[model samples]
Target: MTVADTPQAAAFRRQVLIPLKLRLFLMQKLPMAWLAGLRLRQLTPEQAVVTIRFKFLTQNPFRSIYFACLAMAAEFASGIQAMMHVQAGGPVSMLVVKLEGDFTKKAVGLIAFTCPDGPLIAQAVAESCATGEGRTVVCTSTGVDEAGDVVAIFRLTWSFRAKC
Candidate 1:
């Protein structure tokens, strides 16, 4: 059986993964995220929503949010879902193997990055555990402006492997 296919692991995920305090502490450690004013607005087993304020720190000379800052928010949205899965299943190693971004519209004001691919990530992890081989999944995170317009879309490829 996979490490995450256990009752204890599920309990740990419930008690540790979805806590606001832990998320706040995590943000503190990520200085760039903190400086860019990234916030974890919501997180669940199925989705994660992250936001970045288009303030001076996050803005580029073009009067829009910096590309890197947008990338950071998008990554957080995608990564948080994978984090939840890995935390619940067992000690697994996960990394972003690839990233593709489309700057659809100028990112202005507060941007919300939303990713809804938790089930897909969980399946990839289970596959890796069953096969004892690495599995990769592509997750898409979309950034929306405060006016609900599409700002950017990022496709991230994540590789997962169970620890030996």
Candidate 2:
């Protein structure tokens, strides 16, 4: 069966779809994201969307969202898909080995980060699990403002390794 068809993956999607459940999950596991008001707008096997707003807790001195907060949202856009694949497959460890970001515009209001590399991540996870080796994939997440202007681009390299 495909990774997305797995029961665990379905459960994860369900959990992310429910606002209260997602908030509780974030509160329990990712307190920082919860505090920063990161929200999962969409999630699928092929893509994921996350959003963050510019507020007191997530803004910078320059009156824009902090770069670190933007990175967190970008990472979550890709990381949630990776987590689903990992849970669908056998035991595997995932980590962010590298992160690169390019800011193109001032981020204000609400910013949405979308990552469309879920298939790549799933393949990497499957390869790692099958070969008992580690595999890495670079997932690009793009953040845009409400006007659909590109605000930032983040390339995150995720490594997946099978457990012994």
Candidate 3:
């Protein structure tokens, strides 16, 4: 069997080649973007997990993760989770009025922030929708490094209002 015609080669071509090609296209070749090719997979209304590969440009000296990147990840996780709760026809936008962060350790690998479903988001959305006014919700997110160590903790308070 020739290399091009081998079954294993064909499988690799399908699985590895196509995804890599798509990644390069979307990540490098695109101009109009919001996500910057960040994957939102393993996410849901109750939870948000972001995977960021440590890149030099986005990292601090000593190969440590950047604080700004940690902040971004926190916002992404909390905001997306909150937004998804409003997908059932309830809100305009979440205005982050106040937020605080506590950096505990140096992050050197991918991090995940998870906030599950509960009264907090519901209360915030409900209050905003009920009055057609705004309410505040404080959401906390913790980022863990590759070793499952707490790298950072963030708290965001948002003023929410219904678009309807």
Q: Give the best candidate by lDDT.
A: 2
Q: Among these predicted structures, which one has the highest TM-score?
A: 2
lDDT of 2 by residue, 40-90 (tens): 999988899999999999989999999999999999999999998888999
C-alpha displacement of 80 in model 2, angstroms?
Answer: 0.4
CA-only RMSD, every prediction: 3.5, 1.7, 11.9
Per-model TM-score on C-alpha atoms: 0.86, 0.96, 0.72
Per-residue lDDT of candidate 3, residues 1-164 (tens digit):
11112343234234323445535544664322123333443444345575555676557887876777677767767765565555544545678899899988887767776545324765677678888988788888788878999888888887788877
Better of 1 and 3 by lDDT: 1
| Model 1 root mean square deviation, Cα atoms | 3.5
Cα TM-score of candidate 3: 0.72
Q: Is candidate 1 or candidate 2 better by TM-score?
A: 2
For residues 44-150, write the lDDT of model 1, one tens digit per residue: 66777999888999889999999999999999898877877776666789999999999989988889999988788888987887777999999999999988999
Worst 10 residues of 3 by lDDT: 1-10
